[model samples]
Every structure is written in structure tokens, then in C-alpha cells.
Target chain A: MRFQLTEDQTALRRATRDLLERRFGERERRAAAGGGSLDRALWRTLGDAGFFALCLPERDGGVGLGFPEAVLVFEEAGRALLTGPLIATLRAAGEVPGAASGETVVAAADGWTVEWLAAADVARPDTADAVAVRSVDPLTPLHRVARAARVDPVAVLLTAAEQLGTAVRVCELAVQHARTREQFGRPIGAFQAVQHLCAGLLVRAETARAAVYAAAVTGARTDIAAARLLADEAAVDGARDCLQVHGGMGFTWESEVHLHLKRAWVRAGRGGGGAAAEEALAAALTA
Target chain B: MDLSHTPEDEEFRARLRAWLATALPVLPPPPDPADWPARRARDLGWQRALYDAGYGELHWDASPTTRLIFLEETEAAGAPYVGANFVGLLHAGPTIAAEGTDGQRRRWLPPILRGEEVWCQGFSEPGAGSDLASLRTRARRDGDHYVVDGSKIWTSHAEVADWCELLVRTDPDAPRHRGISWLAMPMDAPGVTVRPLRTLAGSAEFAEVFLDGVRIPVANRVGAENDGWRVTMVTLSFERGTAFVGEVVACRRVLRELAAAARRDGRWDDAVLRRRLGRLNAEFLALWRLTQWNVSEAAAGGGVPGVGGSVFKLRYSHARQDLYDAAADVLGPGALDLDSPWVLDRLSSLSYTIAAGTSQIQRTIVAERMLGLPRGR
Candidate 1:
């Protein structure tokens, strides 16, 4: 009946958080984004630490953990806004062989289009004639892979995990801004308007975190669809709200808040858009 | 985490379901306030039936998992609400069980369990709605009794209640939150009067209660004097109980009904409406999972609720309202008809946002308490 992460899971969370904070803080994150390519060193560091093998099998020379642990690691990755083919690479670990060792970076494909094709050592087997496309999110490199019949739901689930993390991160950012930034000699958080925005974001983030985490554990397509839907909304709208809280500073390129918004906007269209998740939910409910 | 129930819990649920196959009450709450006697009788009869069948004490010492099973099964069986004894069962009974003296528990809890004595809460006043600590309801001591004076508004079921859990200022000179006391007062006491107030939806199930020098024995006090605020807090926390499990079940029912209605009315094909319905359904799923996770967390040794009560209440209220709004979108004018089942629900949903604490206050609680946002100047 208990719903919390276990002591081991909590320890995993703290370690992941500490790693991201020390290795991928604001300056490093922006620099990596500006470089517009994968941080090979950081990626290798994570793989060496078993970040990519949390859900893999011990028999396969990887940690024998579960989806709960996998999502915990992804939650940190999302918070750090870690770039490149992490999701695709993790998914490919059990499929493409070399991916498990961080020696091969597999660019994730969503139907015909893929992300970070230029940065990957390997691409999904189905992708062909990949062509680079200008990306809206500075942190992600987009490519148009040849049209394919399928988009993996696991890919969507991973994107949903990132969205959940970003949602929580933006909520923290909003609260931090609201408490420290003042208007008319009071913290902006003292205003009901700002309070409600922060509160709403907190609810959305917490709610989506629950959904996404449960979906990971349950491995139910319907639950995953709902999680993706909610995480998308939370992250996208939460970033907008956080930007509002930061006022003019948030609009500046120097502020990391806009990066959150850009990433959310880009992620909202990835794996599967709102319409796809909506169809899955509608089918489940109507059927 | 596992969401499935233990075998024993499943068996407990199955037994209740089997009993409810025939024992569950079917009387829809009457629209007419005048029909309250029949309604009250039916509600009590249903409660007594469950009591005799071993549900009255089901929650007294039950695990969170077991209590959730009870609520889920009861909601599934369409069992009637404890009706006029809602306050007694949900708030007062638990408060008595937790804070009452042994004699008070024995004296007060059984009737409540058996549905023999209905209860109402005397907490809100015209001047003290959100700022409840500022209530002017005075309870002055006068030789072994407290002479109570002042009024309370929005006291639901006051007209039908046999007793009330009253909060009053026992010391005007003391700090606002420190001077209060909680008491169990017989509703028929001298100088006690109840005037029914019709809600905007036109249900007279709530009332305004006045006590003009109503003399209640000091023995009625539940906790020590000047500690009433803590008692009141204990009572408020009980509002976030297993009832949320039932609500999730009920919500699924209504959502299915609304979807079916949308299909029959040919509105299901409306892309905008379909998208909205889909989003709302997803939102409901998230909320349900959140609650289930909360229950599972509590069962796994999480502490009793804190600001979470406000958070869930606030979120669930909005979800319910959003559902009804989507219903209206599905049914259009059909939802506006007063005779439509959903019309009453849609009209009544607004009160949820206002009652207990307004949505505004709820947001404040979540911001200041849960998120640690700065308090307003």
C-alpha cells in the first residue's frame, strides 16, 4: 500500500541530484547547449555510474533494477536538461548491444524524424537518408529520418519522464523567483496572482510526477499516454508561468528559464503529440 | 509500488459487496426538504444495516488499505451516504475517538455509529468564514455550565441534527486562536435555534444556527479549555479521509456516463469537445493515481496528513467542476435543465469550491504551507 520510493530509491535520488548539480549546473548546461552537440564526457560519466543501466539485467553485466529506478535517474537527467540521445541510447542498450557501454550513441527516431542524428554513433535501424533540420530547442538537434511506420511508446514514455522533471524544475524556479523577486516592496510571491500561478504549477508538477512514475512502474500503454499528456501540459505551461514570474529577466537569452520553455515546446511535439495521447485515452475510455 | 490489495483486504471488500447486493440502500436524496424525515429514516436504516453487518467499526482501527477498500466497495455498490450523520461520522466521531475522554467516546460514538443521533458542525460564522479564529461565538462560564451566545452560518444538517460539535471563544481576553474550546452540545438546548438556508441550488440541507445564552454543561467540552483550536484542526484534517477513494469511483461513473451521453448526442465526434473530454479524463486519471499513491504512501508509514488535506480538497474540487463543465459541453442545454440529474450536480459543484475553504484560500495554503512560498504581507 505504500507509494513512496524505498530507502534505496531515495539514496539513488540524492546521488543523482548531487551528480547533476556538480556536473551539469547552470553554466555547464548553457555551455553544452551553446556547443549544440552531445557532451561525450558527461554521457560517459553517467554510463560508468550505471545511469543508463538502472533497469537492465545483472546477467547482462548491468544493474538489475526496475523502471522505478530508471525513472528516478531520468528525473535527474530531465532536471539537468541533459541533451543528446540519452533516451534512445538507453532504449537501444538491450537492442543494439554497444549502446549499453556508452560507446554507441543512438539517436532516437519518432516515425520518420529523429533527434540528434549528427551526434549519434548509431541511429535506429529503420532510419535512412537522415537529413539535418534547424531545431527550435538549442539543446536538441533535430533530423528528418526516412519515414517509418512506427514510433515507439517507450520513446514517448521517456520524453514524458523528461517533461515531468522539467515540470518540477520550473515549479522550483517559479517559487524561487516569486520569493526573492519583489514588486512594491514585497516578494512577488506575496501577491495572490503569483501565489496562484506557483501553486498551480506545483500541483501540475506533482500530479504529473505521480502519473509518469506510476506509468513507468505499471508499463500500461493507457497510463503512459495519460502521463505523457499531463507531463506535456505541465512542463509547457509551467515554463510559461515561471517566465512570467521572472518578468523581463526570463525573456532574456541569459536566463535559463527560456531554455526550459523552448525545451518544453519542442518536447510537446516529440514521441507523440497531444492528439496521439488523446486518441489513446479516448480509445481506452470509450472502449 | 503495488496497487493491488492484500488477500484479506480483497476478501473484506468482497464480503461487503456481497452484503450490499441486497442490503445497499437505493433511495436517491429527495429534492424536497419536506421529505427529509423519510430521507433521514432511510439514511439511518442504511447506516444501521451496514453497522449490523460490521461496517460501523470497520474504520475505527482499520489499516489505510482496508479503509480504502471499504470506501471503494461502498462507492461501487452505490451505497447511500451516511446522510444526516455525515458530520458525526466523518468529523465529530473521529474527533471524539481521538480527542474525547473515555466517557465522551462511550457517550458520543455509539449513537453516531448506529446513526441514532445525527450531528452538525458549528464552526463558520458570518464574520469568521476563512478567518475562523476571529469568530465571535462566545462561551462564557457560569457555574458548572458555559453560556453560549452568537451564531454560526452554513451549518449543514443543523435542522436534522440531534447534536453539534461547536467551537466558541471561551476567553475574549486570550489570544484569538488560544481562547477557544470545542464542545458537544445537544441541539435542543434552551435558546438554540436553527434557520434553514437554501443554497443557490435551492437545497435547504444547510442552515444558520443561533445560540442566545444557550447553557451547556462544562462536561461537554472535548478537550482542555484554550486548546479548542487544536481540536478544530484535528476535526478539519479528518475531512481528508477515505472519502476521496469513493469520490474517484463516483467520478469514473459520471465520466463514463458523460462520454456515453456525448456519443448518443453525436457530440463525441466534435474534435474540440473530444479533445477537451480526453484531457479531462487524463486529468482525472492523474488525480486518481495521485490519491492512490497518497493512500499507499500513508499505508507505508507516511505521517498523517498536513497541508495535503487542503491540496487534495482543492484539486478534487476543481476536477469535479471541470468534469461537470465537460458534461455540459457534452450535453449542451440538456445539462441546464433543472430536472436533469447532472443539472443539480453542475449547480452544486460550485459550492465545493467555496465550502470547507474557498479555492483562493486553498491556493494560499498550498503556496504558503506546501510550497513554502512567502506569506502575504
Candidate 2:
């Protein structure tokens, strides 16, 4: 069995990365983050690009690709740090009337909180009495809602794919900073301490990548739970380590390192703060 | 990104499983771990069976996927491991196939594949463990032979091995890494001594060998005189990469057993305990996927593993340790009983981080080779 990406799959990933980087690259992302809301025009552009309809069947006027391909696209979105109801909108593609075409926005309730609820046309569980709350990640605004529902394994796997992407991106950032940033008459990467930190980040990221990719293929509940757990650990811990490699500069609002850590923190809390995945895995093991 | 096996792979798997169904039961009971002769015989008998079935050379001859299938099936069927034959089957045999001369391969490959001989490793010396390039096992050239003089520690199954894949310092003035040569030293040579080294688990599977003027033929050199380090790295990649495929399956089995015990003992009620077992389960499952990734990558890029092997090795070492730690939590007070299940496994888990390559060295490999980080000194 070949566990690596095929030529077409690799090309799809590269193409999706190129598309997202053009729209949500650092400059565009920062410019859009200042508003703290979803850009409808850009959202429609994503819909036109078939981002949301990636997994809808061809009979429904969509891309008809499977979860694996959608997972790849979402990974690129995560790497670009694209915010909004992306996961919710993507999950609602077949169910929500206009979601597949980007004419409608969908937001899924994550426990008692919903992200970008004010801009959403439909909420997954129809939360009422929503109140906007300050979020740690400036780009992702949250609205507290009176709805809590069990998340399906597919959503968990998709969220894990996003975390995998963040893990990989932060690992690259840490390695880059360690190489260029100097301390004690040399680059900090020359020190074993910094080097090991970056190495550990890479190890965690790669391990999570494998798990996420395998889970996408298998789609097993246990596999998805494991993937979620590993991807969360990798993304959260990797961003923290990436920040460590950047030293004082990473602490500034101007640098993108803290943004990644904040985003990772927010995402880790999305699928029940890792407790749900942990409990699911524990149940599987105990059975 | 297909993870499904090919039709041929599935067919081969089916045949191997059928063969093992009949083969494993008729075999005699396994000898004690400390029984060197008996263990050798049992292991060789299994190898001979594989040889007769045309699967003996799968390690080097077949595709990586096929080899993986063989390993998975054998482990699942409770077939014998390459216990006394690991150094030969996994390390030296593959290295020789990759770097040895045609003549050398014809001579050494047949006996090992046929289960007619066993090989032990002679790479780690007393003075050089992690810094293996500084090894001072002197092999002074004299006519057509090299007179080897030194001591090698942690030689596994040396008491039963017929050959030793040796590394020695052939040049004193060259660079530390450039002065070494690889030799195949006969274990029965004069002035060669083997003293079993007792492990913390109280097993003598490893030994220390003292060589005083043990002579080895020049024809036995696998590569150029000073190119042994590269060849040894090839052997080590095999050691770190595919050598542990069987153990992963075994670990999964042990994890299931641990989970069952947790349920039986009412420890499953503890969310913390259940969560620990669950996390270990995830860890092994991820490790298994990582193994598949590495093997698939190796299949694509020749038969040698890349830096990804180090990543897998670094994590798998700790995962095995964690699995046993959870096992102890499941066992409660019985963890200390020597005869209890997994007690020996728990004890042996301590060496996983130290053997093959230390976790420290693995981190260096990943940092420098994989991440492109600057090397420290």
C-alpha cells in the first residue's frame, strides 16, 4: 500500500496552497483581520473556486471529491490562517441550500460558542440568544450560544486536518527563525536547545500528519479521535515551541507567531477541548 | 494515497497466513530465553521453513510492501521472530546485499538465508558507544588478513553466532570517521572471547567480546577500507527502519491485553486510567501509520529509509516505554512480580531509547539532517 500522496493529489495540494496564499496570504490575512469579520466577497470567491463544494457529489453540481481531497484543501486554508465559518460552511455544503455556492454562510455551534455567528446565515443547531464574546485569537470572533451538540467523526477529522496544517506551518516558521535569528555570536539553531525544540516540533507535526492522513482514508471513529488528539497536541505545542525559537520578537503583535499559537489554542478547544477525543479513544481501548 | 494492499500482496498474505496456520502449531514449544543453543535451533528451524517455502529472501529480494506483509502476517499468526538471527537477517545481510561485492554476496548471503549461519554485530566498542566513529578496534593489515584487536560490547547472541560484522580503525592519521573499515570476523577465531553481559532484565542476550589478534580475511571486507562508516550507516538505517515492524504488531497485541486486564480489574472505571490507556492506544496507532508512511516512502525511494526513519524511531521508542508504563498502571501491585505478564517487557523497554541509536542521537539526526538545523560542534 502506498501511503504517500499520488502525483495528482500532490498537485491538488500545491494548487490549493497557491490559491489560498494568493487570497489569504500574510498581507491579505492581516488586512482582513483588522475588521474581525468574514469578507463576503472573498467567501463568494472561495465558493466560486469550489472550496466549499469540494466534497459534494457530482450529481449535485459540485466537485464530487472525497474527504481526503477536502482535507487537503482545508489544510491549505489552515496554513494560510483563513478565518470565518470555513469548517461549518464546508460541512453544510450538501445540506444548506446556498452553502455549496457560497451565497449562504453557515456556522456550527462548538459547545456553547459559535464563531462568526453574526455573519452566518444558518447555525448548525439553531442556537438562540447569541452574545458576542472576546476571543483570544483576534481573527476568530466568537459568539456564545445556548446550544451544545455532539460533533460527528467527520467534523473531528476535518478539524484535525486543519490543526495538522498549522503544525506544519509553525514548524517551518520555527526552523526559519532559528536559522536566521542570531544569539551568542551565531544563529540560535546552532544551539542544541533550540535545535532540539525545532526538531521536536517537526517530529510532532510529521507524526500528526501521518495520523490525520490515515484517518482521512480510514474514516474510523477511533482513528479520527486519535488524529484529533495528535493534531491538537502538535499544533498547540508546535506553535508554543515556534514562539520559543523566535524569542522576544514573537511576543509582539506585529509578528505572526503569537497569532498562530492563539489560533491553535482556539482550534484545540473546538472539538470539546480534546476531552471528547480522549474519552472516545479510552472507550475504544477499554472495549 | 492509497493504503489498500494490491491483489498480489493480498494473495501472498493469504498464502502466508494459510502456511502459518499449519506451521506454527506443529513447531515445538519455544525454548527459554537464556537457552542459547536451543534458541538458535528453534530460530534456524523457522528460517529453514521459510527458505523451503521460497520466502526466506523476502527481506532483501522482495518489495518493501511484500516484506511488510510478511512481517505483519507472521506477527499476527504468532510465527517465530528472527530472534537469534536479527543481526544477520536485518542488518548485515541487507548491508552486504547493498555494498558487498558479487562474490561476497554469493558466499555470505546464501548461508544466512538458508539458516546455516548466524551473525552478530561488532560495531560498538567499550570506548565508543554513541560516538561510534571513535571506535578503536584496531585491524592492522598483514598480507591478505587483518589482525583485529579490541573489545566490543553489547554484541547480541554472539555465543551462537558464526560470524561478526565488524568495524575497526584501519588508519590512525585520517579523520575519525574516515579511518574505519568493515570486516566480517569469524567468531571462532583464536584469541576471540565472549562473556555474556547481563541486562537489567536479567537476560544474557547481549555479550562483550574481547578480540586479541583475531585474524579476518581481506575478502571479507564489504566495502573500501575507509568507507565502512557509510556501509555501517546503511546497516543502521535498516536497524532503525524496518527492524521493528514485527515489534509494533506485538505491541498492539500487548495493548489489547492491557486493556482487557484493565477492564477485568475494574480499573476501567478510573477515567484517568482509561484515558492513559486510550492515549497509548492512539500513540501506537499513529506509530503504526508512521511506519506505513516510512515503508511506503522507502519503497518509492529505493529500499533504504530516509530521515523519516529517525522521526519514527525517536517517537516509537518512547511510545513503547509509555505502553508498558500504562501496563504497570493496569497491573497494580503485580507489576513488580518477575513472573507476571509484561514484567520482562517492561524491563526491556528501558533499552529501546538507548539501542539502535540513542534518542539523543536521533534528535540530532532529525534536527540536522531533516530540519536543516546547524550541528553543534
Candidate 3:
């Protein structure tokens, strides 16, 4: 009957948000945006904090929380726009011992392909030793590293969760822009046209969040596709609206808005594009 | 985090199932609306049987937990009961129980439980669907009766319903919402007329019911005077929640058929359709889970689903529409050909979004109430 987060979940969310704010603030995000790769330090910090281990079994050196709690954490990650091989690491961490403790990183094989593994700290393709990382969104910390593994539904669900987070953040950024950006001496949010756009973005974000969280809790294949579809739409449309809200500044490299847009574009296409997700959804629905 | 039911509840489910095995009769699928009366009678018969077996009033305080268990089990067993008289069982029953005097409940409850009566909602008029308070239905007091005069549109099952749980303006001087009063009126009462309205699905399931100087007994009133809006809201909320689960399950069955068809035709290889189907499946699962969540919550004595129900309704309507659209796309030219049985059934799925409440209206509800956004108007 209630959708509110439990106290532990709320605290976890707040702590995660605070951690991201402290370690990967706007300046750090900007720095990472201009960087060669994602911030490994932040990834390590998350690993140490058991972020990757949230959904793992208790016996697996993890918190053993359910999808709902994982959703809270992922949402916080999205809000922070923290970039790293976080999803891949988390997915791998669940399968391998000490993976969540920064001892290992696993990468997925599909959607994004991993190449040039010599420089990677560990390269286990389709195995526990290898974390496959794909460059679906090169801007983010995702990679197609060689890893020995089977395609995990949990991984797909987690990736969708991360995408949902990114979409929500994009919507928040768009709303903030609409509220502050002035046109004709009034806040653009006051304009009906702008408000509608922001409102649509908000709907997309909220719906996607709801769908994704529901999927996490239910672990239903159809719910997963719904979460993915909403997340995809939110990320893609939210980014577009953010750009619209930012106007000219959004197109520039200096603007984080463009970065979000870029990441969204990459994520939407990654793991499988809109077409793939849509087709799967159609099948699931009819099924 | 433990979503499992208590052992006692599990045992209850089992015992109820055993009882239903003997008490419940197997029935055919829903007949075409063309055979409206026959189908309606059959449905009523089934409902009466259930009521006789003590499966009617699940949540009423007088109804024991055993009765609730039986009702839940019947639902879980996927036994077809009745269709389209939901306004009575879910809404009228509860409202009368909560607000009606003992005499009123005694009069109405037994007939409803016995399936001797069918009730349709008389809330939305042509002018007021979402802005329900703006309804122009007037029911002025006259002696021991109220002289009702106004028309209610989108009255589902009006032609077949024995009675109506109607909302009308009782006091002209009161505020729009405040002036409303809910009364149960017999469909065959003098000055009452029902005109069928056909939907795109080619079903005359709804009607425009006209009330011209219809004298309704004061004893039919359920809730306080000029507080009909509250009663109507409670009814609508129930409509938005529990009342729709069976329908959703039925829709899911249809969706399954469509999927099987797609698979048989080897259309699963179509990448575009596959992705679309996947997403639809996901949305359906989320909705199904939400429905289960609501049911379990109520079983545990949680509050009415409030904003959560609104969110579910909004998403569900859209998802239902999306499912139909996906089916149409997959069915290709066959989708448009209503002469084909498959196409007709697929086309029927389109009504899900528009029937209970339009998707647009549900979205407005979600935005205004759930998100606290400015009214779109």
C-alpha cells in the first residue's frame, strides 16, 4: 500500500548521496567528463562501501539487500551521475568472492564489446576472473572488458536501474534549469510551453523510476523490460528536454547538460537500442 | 521483506480452494454483448451462487475471515463469477456498511449479495467525467422522496442494471462538491430511461441514463446529505483498485493468447516486435505485482491505496492501451479486420484505457494528486 522507502533504505540513500556529493561533486564530475577514463578512486570507494554488494547474498560478503534497497542506492548513484565501471563491477561482484570489496571487477560481454584487455587490472572473459566492460556510453565508466560469465538477468536489471537513475537526474537538472533560466524576464518554468516540457520530463522520470523499482522488487521479465523501456525513454527524452531547457549552453562541452545528453544517448543504445528493448517488451506483453 | 503469506493464510487458501471445488461451478468465457441479457443472467446466477456459498462480502466486518479467505481463494482459483455489476459489490456494499443505517443496509445488502440486483454508477455526465463535482444532476427533496432530474452518461450496464448508485446535487446553495448526495435508485423507477451508447469496440455496454422527475425514496440515501462526493470518491477509489484485478487478469489471459499466436507464426524473430513485446511484458508484470501488493496490503488491514492506486490506474490504463497497440501491430492487416475473431478480440482490448476512465483523465489525476502538479484543465 505504501511506496515510501523504509528507514534503512532512506538512510542508505542519504548516506550514498552524501558520499557521492563529498567525493564526486560537480567539480569532480566536470573533471571526469574531461578525463581519459572514469574515476577508479570513486569506484574503489563504492566497492569498499559495499555499494556493489547491496544485492549479493549475505554469505557472499555483501549486505544481501533486495531489489528495493538496491533501487534506492542506484537512484542515489543516478542523482550523483557518478561515473565508473560501477554496474559491471557490481554485477561481477555478486558472482565472485571479494569482488564487491575492490578485489575484482567483472564486465559484461553483450551490447558493448570489450577490447584491448592487456592494460586492464584483470581480464577474465566469460569467467569469474574477467569483468567485461562495454563502451556503451564512453562518457560513463562502462566498458566491455573480457569476462567469463553467463548473461545474468540481475545484471540486466541492475543496468536498467542505473539507467533509471541517470534519467531521473537528467529530469532534475532540466527542472532546475527551467526554474532558474529566464526568458522575457520571467523564469522559463512559468511559461506554459516550458512547464509542459518539464512536466513531461518529470512524468517520464517518475514513471521510469516506478517501473524500474518495481522490476527490481518483482524480478519479473516483463517488469524488467518495462523498466528498461521507461528508463530508455526517460534518459533519451530527459536529456533532450534538459538541452531544450539549457538552450545554447546545453550544446557546449562545458555544460554538464550535454554530458548527460551524451551519456543518455549512449545508454539508450547500449545493452540494446530502443528497437531491441521495444521488441522484447512487445513479446513479453503478448506473452 | 518477507512477502510470503502466513502459514494460517496458506491453510486458509487451501481450505477455501477445497470448498470452491465443490461449491463453485465451471462457466464458459464471457459471451458476446449481443447476447447481453442471457450473459447477464448467467453472470448473476454465478454471483448468487457465490453469495450463497458465503463468498460475497469479503471485507465487511460482519463477514468472517473465513468468508474473506473464500473470496480470495475464488479469485486466486481464476473462477469466473460475474462481470459489470462491480459498482454494487465493491462500492455500494462498503458505503452502505460504513455510512448507511441498519435499515438501508438490510434492504440493499442482501439483494446485492444474493445477486438479485445489478447496480451501475451514475456519477459522470456528459459535462462532468473527471470534473465530477461539476455534474448537473439535480435531486431536490420532495416529501419523503427526492425528485431527481438530470442525465448521466457513460453509465455502464445501464440497460441491464437493476439499480444505480447515483450522485446528484442535493442543495443548490452548497458548494459544487459539497452539494452532492449519493442515492440508490431503481432503474425501473418512473421517469427513468436508459439509452444505449455504442463504443468503438462495438459494444453497447454503457448508456446515457436519463432521470426526469424520478422520485427516489429517502431511505435509499447512503451517506450524509450533501456529502455524495465522498461516497462517490470511495466508490471510484475502489474502482481504481480492487474492482479491476479480475479484469486485469482477464486481459492478461488475452495477452497470453496474442503471444502464443505470435510464437506460432514465428513472429518472435521480428526484432522490433520482440523488444516491444518484452517491454509490454515487463509493464504487465509490474502492474500484476502492484495489484498483488494492494491485495496483500488490504488483507493485512492497511489503509486504502490512495495515491498509490491512482498511480496504478494511470499506468495500467496506458499499459493496456499499449498492449492493444502492440497486438495490432503484430497482427498487421488482420488487426483492422474486425470480421476475424482474433481481430475482434484484439480490438476489444482497446477499451481498457477508455472504459473505466480515459487514460488522459487518469494522467491528470496522477499529475494533480500524486505529483502535486498544477492542474492541466
> Please, what are the lDDT tens digits per residue for candidate 2 over residues A104-223?
999988766688888888988867788888888889888776656667677788889899999999999999999888878998888888888988999999999889999989888988
Tens digits of per-residue lDDT, candidate 3, B111-182, equal 888878888888889998767789888998889999999999988778888889899999888879899999
Location of the lowest summed lDDT over 10 successive residues in candidate 3 chain B? B59-68
Q: Using TM-score, give the best candidate's number.
A: 2
After superposing candidate 3, which stretches have Cα over 4 Å from the reference? Answer: A1-6, A37-41, A53-68, A91-99, A103-110, A114-120, A126-138, A141-150, A171-230, A241-256, A269-287, B16-32, B59-78, B266-271, B293-301, B329-333
lDDT of 1: 0.83
Flag the better candidate by DockQ, 1 or 2: 2
Which runs in model 1 stand beyond 4 Å of their true positions? Answer: A129-131, A145-149, B25-34
lDDT of 2 by residue, B129-239 (tens): 999999998989899999989999999999999999999999989999999998988899998999999999998979999999998999999999989999999889888
- Superposed Cα RMSD, model 3: 4.6
Sorted on lDDT, best first, the list reads 2, 1, 3
Better of 1 and 2 by TM-score: 2
lDDT of 3 by residue, A176-234 (tens): 77667777777776555666566566666766766776677667766676777677777
- Runs of candidate 2 exceeding 4 Å displacement: none
What digit string (tens of lDDT, one per residue) describes model 1 on residues A1-287? Answer: 55678889899989999988988888888787776778888888888888776667999878888877877788788878888788888888877776877877887677556878888888776567778888888888887765653667777888888898899999999999898887899899999899999989988888898789888878898888899998998999999999999999999988899889988887887754678788677766787
Count steric clashes of candidate 1.
Answer: 4
Candidate 2, DockQ score (0 to 1): 0.77
DockQ of each: 0.68, 0.77, 0.31
Write the number of the candidate with greater TM-score, choosing between 2 and 3. Answer: 2
